[model samples]
Target: MAKRARPGMRRKAIVLRDIDPPGTLATNLFRAVYNPVVQAWASGAERIIAAYAATVSEMTTDAPADVRAEIDGAAEQINRLVLLLTPDLRRWALSVEGYVRGRWRGAVLSATGVDLQTVIGPEDARQTLANYVEWNANLVADVSAQAKQRIGNAVFSGLSQRKPAREVAKDIREAVSMSRARSVRIASHQLSSLSGELARERRREAGLEVFAWHHSRKAHPRQDHVVRDGKLYTENPALVGKKVDGIEVRAAPPADDRAGVKPFCGCRERAVMVFEFDD
Candidate 1:
């Protein structure tokens, strides 16, 4: 006779659809909070880039020291811009926290019929906010670093190739322009990821039994996520904590090492409700 399946060993698949479908809640919330901050950052980044471009445009000779000094000076300006935007970034973070908290509470209630506030308590909310603050700080730091690297590369490459000042200026302009676009995309993606993570946490805390990875058809489907899409995993301590494709689905911060939730990734998580047991 075939061996019997262990208790909770065979997961019954459950499809947890996105609470806020793409371009609906995710896009709207992200734009509402992120647009103003990103616009400010873009404005500051452009000014810095323009200054660097002007310096390069005026360069009569490709002196490495002079080029390096100009690049360093530009990096300082970018750092200052990041500092100037800290208040706005903090506001954006708070907005995200509020949005995620509400969505998570609603999703848990809808899936399990349990009020998340009653089960998870205020401590969980505080922890969630703490995580958001850390995540936001890291994001701002990354933007600063990217700006420096991008500007530095433009200056170094143009000078190395001895490109004409006007051409170098053009390249810098293009780089800065691209950065603005990328910033918006990144902000949107991170908002989606944050929501997925918080919702999963709330569901787990509310004693849900299963969880599913919701793949984005709009995203370039990765084999890892594609294979796992819509499939369910038990929320038992052993299984939920187990790594699949280098991602612990129930991880507090949501695993970032994978393509689905990595920077600019648009994947979401769906909390699966199994009625076999009652909480």
Candidate 2:
């Protein structure tokens, strides 16, 4: 038998749709910067990669220094790319915040007969979230930086082995592709994690003690989280060990294993307003 959602429980999906657009835009922005830059490295006679390859063909030791300089330049370019994406990422996070605030306010009022005051109010949380957006945006930048390093190493190693410019270009393209994929993952994870964290704080502030485990009904859901769906748990027990389903005590979920948190499971919490209102 299915347990119907109790009062104050909002399906996390209502806000899940808000997670993807900015991530998509971030990916597109990254690709715009990543693809052309990498392509320029290996193209025409004057191309950076072509020039480096030519030096190696001529058996010149000076090629290493020149290529190193180019590598450093590429790294700086990757750093600057973060500036372009940060604004959009911050806006996306704030949009998620707006939706979560709306969802939480409506749910709490409907269930508790009291309008809950936000403990994690925007005044306190805004700067923190902005910093979070900056941090996550840097994550995308880091991927590109790492990709640049790989391209440098691959080009030098390949040329020394007498590999063609086209071969080195292949490796460079693969690195760019990998970096783009990682940027997408970082964006998606940041949005979902931010949403869940903000919601968790709101629940705590409202004095909600128990919450239903809501499995993300996305394709290929994790089985453990799926099993937890509709069950109740409390993070109120010192924010560490928790009471699961009101039947057994369990440790707080490990940081990496946090249900519906980022970089892993997407499961979310549906706070249950079990408080008695003094009318």
Can you give the TM-score per candidate against the true fold?
Answer: 0.66, 0.72
Per-residue lDDT tens digits for candidate 1, residues 50-102, read 55455556665644555566556656655665556555555555555566666
Q: Would you list the clashing residue pairs of candidate 1?
A: none
lDDT of 1 at 47: 54
Q: In candidate 2, what are the lDDT values of residues 1-279, reduced to their tens digit?
A: 012225564432111112222345434444543344334333321345665667667767787677667767766765665567666666666766766777776665554445545443565458657776777666666666677777777777876787777777677677666765665665566656777777776766655565666777879887887877766566556533443334332344566666557464567777664433112
Off by over 4 Å in 2: 1-47, 83-89, 109-121, 127-131, 238-252, 275-279
Scored by lDDT, the top model is 2
- Model 1 alpha-carbon miss at residue 263, Å: 3.6
Name the lDDT of candidate 2. Answer: 0.59
Clashing pairs in 2: 260-266, 260-267
What is the TM-score of candidate 1? 0.66
Worst 10 residues of 1 by lDDT: 1-10
Error of 2 at 275 (Å): 4.5
**Deviation of model 2 at 113, angstroms:** 5.9
Measured over all alpha carbons after superposition, the RMSD of each candidate to the real structure, in angstroms, is: 7.7, 6.5
